[model samples]
Target chain A: MIDKRVGDPAQAVADVKDGDTVLIGGFGEAGSPIELIHALIDQGARDLVVASNNTGNGQVGLAALIAAGRVRKMICSYPRSSNSRVFPELYRKGQIELELVPQGTLAERIRAGGAGVPAFFTPSSVGTVLAEGKEVREFEGRPYVMERWLRADFALVKAELGDRLGNLTYNKTARNFGPIMCMAARTAIVQVSRIVEPGGIDPEVVVTPGVFVKRIVEVANAAHESVLVAQGVTYP
Target chain B: MTAELIHAGLTRDEMARRAARDIPDGAYVNLGIGIPELVAAHIPPGREVIYHTENGVMGFGPPPPEGEEDPELINAGKKPITLLPGASFFHHADSFAMIRGGHIDFCILGAMQVARNGDLANWSTGAPGAIPAVGGAMDLVAGAGRIVVITEHCAKDGSPKLVDACTYPLTGRGVVARVFTDLAVVDVTSEGFVLREIAPGVDLDTVRRLTGAPLLAAAGIKTIEP
Candidate 1:
């Protein structure tokens, strides 16, 4: 029987260990898995290296996790936004590390990791500072720099719908990074707004096949990150 | 025009409208954050341009009505937006493939400085204490077919932005094709900065004084009207 359902966020994230690399699915607040992140904070994993598009805004989701002093490093394209106050302070104080990658290169690295390719060449950062330490080669006289694939021990994702067997579908632009992160991680822990039976979700409409996801938790009403930030809410 | 713009050149909206007129119909376009974003509202009425945001959406419409913003349905800027009838969503890998694979026709961007050789430097100043955050600027410049830049003619301190060489770190080498500034419309060619048009009430000598490099007047230059 291949049931991947778990009781709650805590149970879904219970196995995350210290010093693990975690891929968090989101572009700003769109597909951020807030409940699962809070549960991971409760689970007390430390010294984690997180990769996402942006550090969380205000002090609620990813920011709260960083505020609690859990993350040791962040690998992302952008780390600053209008309300992003937490990471900059810690980063300037030399409390954390940052590896800045170009946005498209970051996406391609994740895609390459899941697709079983080891490395790829891209022209995105060919002559910029980001390409300084990389190996550059020419194809038909145009230069490209090589970037390695990025994989993680765990990935936390938010989805619109899922089944007990772990097939997932996402909502609109919130779907960014969820499907790819699922493929790039060893165990993908997903919090979905609704869960259905195995046959309820049409096979053609499944964005992520059950083979990639490992655990599923039903979070009937997920809180929007911006709303929580607007209300001045901070997680424990 | 305001007193400041009267002395300087065109207004920001006017610069956007001037750049909007050059885009061809049925082109797929990507607009960068500030002044380039204004190009969307001023796109010529007869043209049908499709918008692509780096996050994962295409054919997006204007901002949704106030209070109807959905956090899940947003642009690359993370601001709320509405999807047109043919709007489509994909993952990040596919979205970037559309950009890096040379599928997007045009990309308009905001610039901090652009050199005579078309080297762009908008991402960072390499300042010691600055927290550098480069979202997708490099990829768009490197991959998009024709790169257009829209910016103020000068920096805040009245320093020239179109320079002989970029002192700040480069975003992409030899990538910018054309630049639309408050004072003039200029093209970066093998010969250097060639003036295609000058703003109304602005003289060639004022533009010559403001520019950091040698300027040449195109044979058939026209005055720009907002």
Candidate 2:
């Protein structure tokens, strides 16, 4: 039996070293690994290139991580959220760099990376500024811009349930980038609400199989930035 | 002081309703933010249209009941939403795959400007202070089978939004099929912008005068359904 369970959040993310590209999965605040993100912050990895759908909202999770001066750059679609302030301030002051990909392109790049595709042409941002200096080709008489694959050193994802072997299930929209992130990274560390045995989950419902997952961290109460904002939670 | 008259067009909800009429039954539609989002409320009962939100959800139903809003469950614009019975959610990559893969039948998006050649520019004005937020408009416009642009007829400063060329950043070129302005419904054909309908109480002369391009009246003028 290949058990991928880790003792705690610290151990789960202990392998993520400085200067590694980390793919943190989430859309807005849904499906974000807040506890593991906090643990990563405590781990104090520096000069990391963080790729995500959004930066951080409120002052928790990714935003807090950025505030702590951990991330050196971010590759994302939408970096701003309702309560997000840290990224903007750092972005303007030239402390961090940004590679803004269209939301669909970002997701597709990750998906392509996981499927072992090195590059693919897409029509998403053909004529926009995002397509500048990229290879453009005519496929079936329609123009498509070539997008390279995006892989991460490690991916921190949030799942609703996980078996010891790392078969993961997810919550609603919270599953936003979890499944794809697991496949696009070398080491996938999932934060689950509950941990069960290998045979605990029905084979049919396993959204992300254990083969892609490297570690599973059980965090019963996964804090979300959206929930915190709803509850009027903030930080100075 | 002499009294002056002002011209106004359909309300936001009315524009949404007009756009909804074009959607066929069982169409997998993606509604962009702003006026397009209102189409969900006006989706005429009995139409089995499945709504897709890019934040990773399909089969949007209604606004969730008060106090039942789930923070984790939200639309692309980050607003809480309700899910229909058969609604499914997935990761970001899958959501975009559904979009770029051409699974969506139609897309109704809000725009800042649309060109006579069907070019769309809604994401940014490229102004110094304007936030450059292009979520999924480019992907939907480029991949959806057809694109319907719903927007106010003109900017608040009295500049027309439907122009010969877009002055803002282009989201996609030659992607828009139809444009539903507050005052008129126009189709973007190879010929040019053809006026299809005029808002109630509005005249063809008034619409022609306000349009920035050479507008041709359609053979049949349809009513702007509220």
Candidate 3:
């Protein structure tokens, strides 16, 4: 059993070391573990290999890590304009390594890791560049490409609410990358705005149960910067 | 009543060429994944349509040749894609911004079903044991200037896919503008559904008979010119 309560974001993220592989859960700022990410950035961690569905918004999400020059490598489905400047420049200068995976395959790889399935096969990448250097197998007379599972040393996730036992719930798009990432990493750290007692959450509503989560921190305001940037505009 | 026969059973590539011809120069377009992706390959030379992808790529191009595939470049589906000049990648936020902000002028999406009222339900079929994924179809329908659907005319069961109403989960309500199927080009207008042109070798009545919904004929409907 893992402790659901932690001292602070810094302490939870302190377990991360240089050159460590980490998965930060988010799909464009929806469910990003902003507190832990801020801690990692503030700590000035370097040479990190970060894996996620997409980079954070510029100056706000995981892009901050790239902007801080902390990420030495990136494994993702796509690199967008928010972090686009960093990738090509670093690749040209031979400073960073970038590995792109098919989005569905990437999602499956992480899901497989969480499920303890070492590998699986799909036909999506066959005959494409994605099939290069990968083992190919035939099932039912059709070619299927095999992809390995993705595991990270640490997984940082954000949730809308959690129980003292670490069970979590997410809202809308924020749920995109959080639940699967929680199981694919060796240590799962979560940040939530509200924490309730164990058994307080309904089992049906729990997106990620307590067993997979190792630590949890409470953040007063996850979108403070974005709100400040928006100033007087009301957010829904 | 015309004697000119438009070719039926055209290849997917040919359908792509037909679709690309309708996209005017200087339009910002979004190509849905799968067969719709081929549209980028057939873009007419000298046309300046900027491609916006949900994965945060704009000014997109075709896939790179084998051995030259850059792992860093990919499309909305996460497949490796190439970037044209003046292309840029941004965080997913900005990518959705381009979509939801109405910066896109055209969206050419593949469809499972299109209704007489122009309702589109392409994201998930809701079929048991089928893959369930909705992606960014909702944003494309609501944000793009025009929503064009590209798909085949019928299912394997020989049932017409163009229906009175979509049976599958709808990505948007009454959002489609025009549709290009294997057999015909139809427009969803305020008056009703109208057949603009039929594919070569297919008659307008045959096309109408195969469709499940009521379809009206354009005043000067004819076989589509290649």
Each model's lDDT comes to 0.93, 0.87, 0.74
Per-residue lDDT tens digits for candidate 1, residues A31-74, read: 99999999999999999999999999988889999999999999
Q: Model 3 — TM-score against the truth?
A: 0.55
lDDT for each residue of candidate 3 in B129-161, tens digit (9 for 90 to 100): 432344566656756788998887876667778
- For candidate 1, the per-residue lDDT at B200 reads 92
Candidate 2: where is the Cα deviation over 4 Å? A230-236, B1-5
DockQ of 2: 0.72
DockQ by candidate, in order: 0.88, 0.72, 0.04
lDDT score for candidate 1 against the true structure: 0.93
Q: Which ranges in model 1 have alpha carbons more than 4 Å from their true place?
A: B1-6
Q: Could you give candidate 2's per-residue lDDT for residues B1-226 as a string of tens digits?
A: 1101356579889999989988988899999878998887777778889999998899878788899998778899888898889999877788888898999999999888889999999888878744466778788888888899999877776677889999999999999999998788999999999999989888888788777788988998986866
Q: How well is each residue in B1-226 modelled by candidate 1, as lDDT tens digits?
A: 3334436588899999999998899999999988898999999898999999999999999999999999999888888999988999999999999999999999999999999999999999889878888889999998998999999998887788999999998999999999999999999999989999999988899898889999889998899979
Prediction 3 global C-alpha lDDT: 0.74
Candidates ranked, most accurate by DockQ first: 1, 2, 3
